[model samples]
Target: MSTHTSPAAGPDAPAQPQGGRHAAGPGRAGRDGGLGGVARRVSLGRPGDPRWARPGLWGVLALAAVLYVWALGRNGHANEYYAAAILSGTRSWKAFFFGALDAGSFITVDKPPLALWVMGLPARIFGFGTWSMLLPQAAAGVAAVAVLHSAVRRAMPGGYGHAAALVAALAMTLTPITVAINRDNNPDTLLVLLLVLAAWFCQEAVRTGRMRALVVSAVLVGLAFNTKMLQAYLVLPAFAPLYLVMAPGTSLRRLGHLLAAGAALVVSSAWWMVIVDLWPASDRPYVGGSTDNSVRDLVIGYNGLGRIFGSGGGRGGGGMGFGGEAGAWRLFNDIMAGQISWLLPFAVIALVAGLALTARGPLRDTRIALLLWGGWLAVHYVVFSFSSGTFHPYYSTAMAPAVAALTGLGGVLGWRAYRRSRAWSWVLPAGIAVTGAWAFTVLRRSTDFVPWLAWTVAAITVTAVAGLLLARLGPRLRLRVAAVALAAGLAAGLAGPAAYALTPLGSAVNGTNPTAGPAGSGGFGGMRGGFPGGAREGGPEGDGGPPGGTPGQNSQQGTTGDAVPGARYGLPADGVRGGGPDGAMDQQMIEYLRRNLDGATWLVAVSGAQGASSVILSTGLPVIAMGGFTGSDPAMTVDRLDGLVSSGRLRYVMTGGGQGGPDGGGSQVTEWVRANCAAVKASEYGGSTDRSLYRCG
Candidate 1:
């Protein structure tokens, strides 16, 4: 290949200086001083940046806030599982640090406590409620958009930087899955933010040649790991290589810097695991998803390799059943495509064309931008495409940042190629054609949903492509024609996702497997089976049923036993009664527990967190999730149960709620409870005959 630089890849004027050290230069600071200066700087961006830059960034963030926080409490406690943990954390520092499911610290939530800590401290000050628990996630989502803008802007210099940055931020903010995940309490929201921040820091490292920036980027990745284990490391393939290739230094020196950053990553990621593992088992809650009550096993097993190879049990044994199957087309499958694939086709084209255009440029050429985003997309695409373990559509939120960044970068590069009359200018119209077709196909999948949309997208795509090709013939009209074509292309590209992204605003998304779009728009809507006691057979209208059922029955049945009524996917709506795993808690049961608690630390002990969560959230009392999340964890032993009972720390045990039954040593505890404890009648507690409450002392 020729070593000559492509116009698209050649050095351009820097929009912001390296290291951001000179962002507020002496002359600029002197002219605009004090808090007023800071405010102006914040509102207008750096003096060097375009006037539209900061305002566009704020607009993107404002959009994100509206999308994420508008109907924030519509879903109530969102994911009651995490909401319960956050509630507990607010009550006790131990629960806050360990991510315990109850105030009494019975068992920790499956993931690390970092996300819990982020939501918990605020809940502590604000008092736990729907808003307090989920607002932080919304804030994190907005911050992720801002940081992604900065990263993309930093990578592309001159006029292209501002547009690319704003486009990337807007793409991220409007991504359907990004909206769904950020609105709920899942750790994925914070994970996306941290990973995006890491990417920004890595860009800073490359721009400034500052080793500290690289190390900070590594530390951010470590924090992301704590937010969601091995999933966070997915960005490493993107981050490490970018620094090694683009950072200014000799190979040996760059390698040394990477090693130091690697060490920092290890320390930051391992510190919590180390402390938790070192704590005595007797004094701490058992690790919820591990075979052994050790954080190391939790990481190495359930949260790590098990999530990839599907071995260590829990939910990872069988795939989450949401992502269709393990194949390359999985992301585009009915169950997943709407969530994150709306812009994927365009992104792929961008990556290839951008890379080919910049292939001959110097090391620091913008090709590294393609490598960073493309590598991020590639690794996640492969793993998510093939990983046979516990996968959900929401997990694809991790891929949104890469897709958004690539979409922005690729669009700009393609535009640059077109403007410069490069041979690859055809790639621009081709990308628009491909993206429009894909959008039409995806929109067609939801036949009844805005029937006109698919055709509208197809029409726009045709018009945009024709205009682009025609613009080439008339150089005088090229600028105006191409501008309109590009705008139409952007509209066609974003229309599908933008429509799907709005669905969550109107309906309550399933907190567990949060997928965007109208009900049955590829989400696992039918998965909301009625819980054991009184949970209705199906969910709300437009919410698809599980497999086979009458359309009306499927759409109208309330999520009673398993799910909170009025909530999608069976999650509880605010003010819904909290009884057992099924949201079937009776007033009688609440009164019975209140009267009988005596001086016991626990109000009741149930098989799983689902069983414990509602009760805890309702009464603000300690309810032990004996077997942790799946009720399969050996979090409870017969000996420990005996000791708690003997010491008056426990009094009641409710068994059999369709939450997984006790596995391993927990089975022994169940047997002991059955053999020795006196069973309380269903009539007494107003509970179902299927699940019995035993009064043990």
Candidate 2:
């Protein structure tokens, strides 16, 4: 895919003669923009314009989408977290993590609501299906690549803008990790796209010094928080030095910019934090090895400290930092290599070379910008390494934009250096020959002669060579066509290996994949959405297991598709028949509850004094559990649970399923009834046609 292309300038192009003289300089030609100015520079008097040029970007997007869909041909199932959330929210309706009022499934991990809202909507509409969830991530991929193209166009001039963007889009279009995540259900794709937006916003902020760009940076950061957590916080500093070192003179005014950025962060992440903090510890559920950590634990420990140090990064639903296993260290290294092995060493060399070449001109700024990106990545990883932090391989995506952009920058400069001297003739072509070697290696892998996840390095190497060849083509031929074709070929090559190696969407990950979840649901800690029942699976509160008792443990360990008996209001318990009268009543309650919740909305509910929460049951709402049952009844924790639920801190209740729950505790079922036992139809299990359901009021 290597090519050196410099397109024929449009007649009116600033680089061309209005009559004879070249209009702009090399480092700054494409940097300026105003209506009249753009018209002159882009040659509105000639061939390209928004009408035609846009199609190229759009065409790339379309191609990316198609590749994404193709990835889906091999994509069948998704991460457990997504499935569990959908199942729990749609089916059991637990709003809290461990609020096992009904019967919970998810545990340990803490995440923002944005991702769940995504899955929940499609589930509510088409009813928990695949394509809907997968498609959104695909959209994220398109956006990321599109933005990458735009960013590349801005950074490097000449018609190289279009070439860089096309190459970037093409490269991303075919990345195995990107394709897999886009086709599968996980939040990393979102994180990657957000980071992409963030980096561009940073670039824009530096170039324009616009307050809006600063705010947008904040907003994107916040979105990253919503998508994942601090995992994306890595964006801020990634470009800090870029602005400081590259832009220079950015002091007094920068304070205001920092304030705006900080404000955006506070505005975005606080709502969930406040509510999460208010929930009772006992009310939570832990699954996928995730232990029921408190809201504080979730926000600070699991989410905050855990990411930096090690709160949850373990076999259990540990976050990025809970003490990891010996093999986990390898995972961190693997994730890094998996993402940008082609660039790590090359970036280092480029950084050194870029710095050495900069004689304090614009090259200095560009070089600093490039180096800061790599620095940010190195620092983030080093800091993370020192702490007992949890590191998901996908977290590597945060580093992608920085690494990729720099890698591209490095390639451009390397090509330029080679062109400057005939003495290095063998070096450039020789490197490409080696790339062709890798290309063949990838081709062999893609052929299924060996493994899946054919390292993107293979294709990336090919793209490097393509880039070199494209650069050699000069400013005459339409290298754009060949550039795009090469990009597609590169993507196609990478896709083959991943396609063959990746398991079906819902199928267990291939045995060789370290990041793949364990063979069964319970042990599948590394799996994305590593929860039970698919999204909305029986949450602690929703799982209508033995009352008073906890959600039934999966006695049948290490299994997928072992349908846990689901509770219901209207729908018959998945497989159970004739649930007991109480279970039937629970089902009725569930039916009532479903009427209230908006698929993509977030809400907090509180029980009233009379404990008359028929509103909760009758609505099938996503209620955070709270204390209730009034009239001075000493046993009414509903008031407390109600407050918690109202604050979005609690989730569900148990009733009739047991006694040993409240002061007047009955069996686990009765206790379940008193706590969650709304008068609805719900069942957990049955004997042939004779099943049982529970009711609570």
lDDT of 2 at 206: 70
**Candidate lDDT values, in order:** 0.77, 0.44
Candidate 1 on 1-697: residue-level lDDT in tens?
Answer: 0111224445354544432423555676686789977888899776666667788788888999999987665555667788788888877888888999998998999999899998877777766765666789899999998888888887776657778888888998989888988988999999999998888788778666788999999999999989888899998988898888778988888998899999999999999999999999898888888888988888878888888877755454456656788888999999888889989998999999888887774424467667888889999999999988888888999999999999988888888778775587899999999999999999998787788999999999999999999998877968789989999999999999998887777655566667677556544643232111012232333422222212111122324333323233343443223324454556467667889899999998887787688677666788998878877887888899999999999999877666665722236776798888998886776645434678898
Candidate 2 residue lDDT tens string, 349-458: 54555454443444433554466556656765554545555554444445555555554565454444554544442344443344345444434422432343345545
lDDT of model 1, residue 286: 87
**What total of clashing residue pairs does each candidate reach?**
7, 159
Question: Could you tell me which residue pairs clash in candidate 1?
Answer: 526-545, 531-562, 535-560, 535-561, 561-582, 563-570, 579-585
TM-score, predicted candidate 2 vs. hidden true structure = 0.59
lDDT, candidate 2, residue 631?
14
Model 1 TM: 0.89
Q: lDDT (0-100) at residue 322 of candidate 2?
A: 22
